[model samples]
Target: MRRGFLWDGFDAGIAAALAGDPDTARDHFERVLGEDPLAPGMVDAQEKTRELHALAADREAVAARVVHSCRSKPGLDPVRLAMS
Candidate 1:
């Protein structure tokens, strides 16, 4: 399912961010956003992604931070992590 793929991608991005791969995480987050900009938690994801992007133009930094934050957090559910 497209939704499933997006969710998985989101999860991966979060995981990647927590792992310190901001670039990869950013890419995944971007992909998820692109897939469903109107999704429930897409707005938040978009905001976070944008922040990460602004934090570092380099993709690596973005991914790293994203993964790190997601991993450290307790309520980062990809399915519920929409833009709404």
Candidate 2:
């Protein structure tokens, strides 16, 4: 397979894993690993895949909390948000 194909497959795997499809994600990730065993991005992709899997496994604990702090109610600091 082409390098771009592997890259796209890896991207899709991350998306699938985040969307709660571990089987498909694992298959795609394995394919990516087979395609480029020594690629620099393999480690990062593997780590992110595992993270997404863990997040999917415990989605309830990863709920988003709306922090209503002392900031302005109507607007956010664009610079601060960008930095974050």
Q: Could you say which candidate leads in lDDT? A: 1
Candidate 1 lDDT over 2-84, as tens digits, reads 66466677677666665667787778767766765666677676677566545544545555565567776786543323221
Candidate 1: where is the Cα deviation over 4 Å? 1-4, 37-84
Model 2, residue 29: distance off in Å is: 0.4
What TM-score does each of the candidates earn?
A: 0.44, 0.44
Error of 1 at 81 (Å): 21
Steric collisions counted per model: 24, 0
